[model samples]
Target: MTTSPTTISVPADHVLVWSDEFANDGLPDATKWVHETGRNKEGWYNNEKQYYSGPRLENAQVHNGVLTITARKESNSDQTDWGGQAYSSTRLATLGKKDWTYGFFDIRAKLPCGKGTWPAIWMVGSRGAWPAGGELDIMEWVGSKPERMFSTVHTTAGSGGNGKGADAPIADACNTFHNYQMYWTAQQVIFAVDGKVHFIYKNPGTGVDAWPFDAPQFMILNVAIGGDLGGAVDDAVFPVQMDVEYVRIYQKSK
Candidate 1:
C-alpha cells in the first residue's frame, strides 16, 4: 500500500520552465520535438515490429489541442530505413532540444487500447549508454494487460528483467485521460498518476551502477507494436492512437 500525494499538481516551489500545449494543429513543434529513428527500443529493436515514421503527420500529429501518436498495421515499400517494417508508429523525443537533470513532470494523456500496443511516456539519461546512464519510466502500458500501468527504474546495478519496477491497477486507462507524472530530484524519483503514488526509487548512494540519474535526461513518447513486452498482435485493432493533451515541466527556483 502507498499513500502521500494522492493527486497530480504543480509544486508550489517550482515554476514552469518548458511546455507543449499543442494549441497549433499539424506536426509537433519542431523547436521542441524530434522524430527519433533507428531501432524502436521500447522492447528490443529486433523484437519490435513497428517502423517509426519519421516526422510524418500520419503517424504523429496535433489537432484541436491534442497530440496524437498513432500505430497502424500498414506497410510502405520505401521504408528501407526501418528494414521494411510491416507496421508503422511514431516515437517523439526532446533529445537535442532540451534535457533536464531534475524536475516535476505533469502530463495528461489517454492510452490506446489494442492488445499488442505498447504505449510509453518515459525518460532516459542523455549521456553515456543504457543501464550505465539510467532510465526512468513514468508510464508503460501494454495492451495485452489493460488493467495495470507500470513505472520502472533501470540502472547498471538493476536492469532488464531485474529492474526495480512496480504497477498500479487501472481500468479506464484506454477510455479516459489520466495524469501521468514523475517527481525527480537528487535523492529519489517518485512515479504517480492522478496524484496517486505507485512507486519510488531512491539514489542508493552505492555508485554510478546503482545511481546514475544525476546526469541530464530527455523525455520520450511513443506507441509501439508487438514486441517481447507488447505480446501478440490483434490485427483487427489497427490504427490505434494515444492522445496527449499537454506536457508541462517545472523545476525548483534556485
Candidate 2:
C-alpha cells in the first residue's frame, strides 16, 4: 500500500531554487532545456521505436503555461533507427545547463493514453555511465497499463531488469494531472505521486555501485512510442502527448 504524506505543500522553510513555468508559448526555454537527438545504438536502451527529433515545434513545445511533448507516427528519413519504425518523439534534458545534487523535485503533468505511449519524468546522475551513475525514475507510465504508474531507482549493483522498482495504482492518470515528485537526500530517496509516498530507496552507504546518486543529477522528460515496455503501438492514436504544467525544484532554507 502507498503511504500518504500529511501534506503536499513545499515545507515553509524550503525555498524555490529553480522552475520552468512555461510562461511563454513556443519552444522550451533553451536556457533550461536541451533536446537529446537521434536514436541510440541500443535502440534507446529499451528497444524503443521513435527517432528522437531536435528542438522542433512538432515534438517539444511550450504554450499557454504548459509544456507539451508530442509523439507522432511519422518517419524520419534522415536517421536510421533500430526498430525500422516510423515514429518520432522528443527527449529533453537539463544535463549541463541545469544539474543538481539533492533537492525536492516536483512536476505536475498529465500522461498520454493509448497503447505504445511510454511517458517518463526521470533523472540520471551527471557523472559516469549508466548503472554506474545511477537513475531515479520519478514517474513512468506505459499506455498499455493505464491504471498504474511506476517508480524505480537503478544502480550498478541493481540495474537493467534487476533494478529496484515499484508501482502505484492511479486509475485516471492519463486524464488527470498529478504531482510526480521526488525527495532526495544523503540518506534516502523517496518517490511520490500527488502527496502519497509509494516507494523509498535507502542509501546502503556501502559503495558507489549501490548508491551512485551522491553526485549531481539532471532531469529528463520524454514520451517514447513503442518500446520493450510500451508493448504494441496503436497507430490510430497518432499524435498523442504528455502535458506538463510546470516543473519546480526546492532546497532546504539556506
Candidate 3:
C-alpha cells in the first residue's frame, strides 16, 4: 500500500493562507485560476520547446480529489490552429486572481515519466513578464532521468547570478509523491523536496529585472510535452499525465 506523505504542520500562530486540496471533482476552482494558451514568441524559457496552451478541460481535469494535466500527440490535422507540432494541452496559473510575496508554498505531486515530460511547480512575478520580472523554479523535472529533480532561480543577472546559485539535483523524485516547496522571505528563498532542502538564494540583487520577487507573485503548475527543456517528445510516449494530490500555503504570523 502507498502511504501519503506526512501532513505538514503549521504553527498555531500562523494561519492557513491558501490551498487547493482538490477535493472537488471536475474543473479547478474558477475563482483562483486562469488558463494560459499559445506559445510565447520566444518559446518556453530554459530552451523548453513546448507550446503552453491555456487551460482546456480536455487537458486539465480533476477526479477523485486529484488534478491531472495530460499531454497527448495527434496527427497534423488534429492540431489546433495555434503554431507548433501536433500536441495540445493546457497551463494553469494564479496570476491576477491571486498573488503572494512571502509564504510557504507546497505542492504534493507525482511527476510524469517518459523521454519528453517536463513537469514543474513554480512561480512568476506579478509585474510585466518573463525574466524581466524574475522567475523562481521551486521544482522542475525532466522525464529522461526520473531519479533527479531540479531547483533554480532566474533573473536579469542571468544563470547562476554571478555564480551564487545553481540547479541542484534531488534523487528518487519521480518514484513517489513528494512535497515540492518554496520558503520565501524578504531576505532569502529556499527550495526543497520532501522536506529536504536543495537550493537557496540570498540578497537578490535589485529592481524588477533583479529582485521582483519581493512583491506579490502567483503560482503555476504545468506538465509540458517535449519542448526545449525536456527535449523533443518521444513519439512512443504519446500520452503522459502529471498527478497532483494537493497544494497548500502558509505564512508566518506577524
- How many pairs of residues collide in each model? 3, 0, 11
- Which candidate, 2 or 3, has the higher TM-score? 2
Highest TM-score: which candidate? 1
* lDDT of candidate model 2 versus the reference: 0.88
What's the candidate order when arranged by decreasing TM-score?
1, 2, 3
Q: Candidate 3, which ten residues in sequence have the lowest lDDT sum?
A: 2-11
Backbone clash tally for model 3? Answer: 11
Off by over 4 Å in 2: 1-9, 38-42, 78-84
- Model 3, stretches more than 4 Å misplaced? 1-13, 40-55, 75-81, 159-171, 204-209
Stretches of candidate 1 off by over 4 Å are 1-8, 40-46
* 82-156: candidate 3 lDDT, tens digit per residue: 444466556789877888888888899988778888888888878865666677888888888776788778776
lDDT of 2 at 104: 90
Candidate that scores best on lDDT: 1
The digit string of per-residue lDDT tens for model 1 on 114-133 reads: 89999999999999999798
Model 3 vs. true fold: TM: 0.84
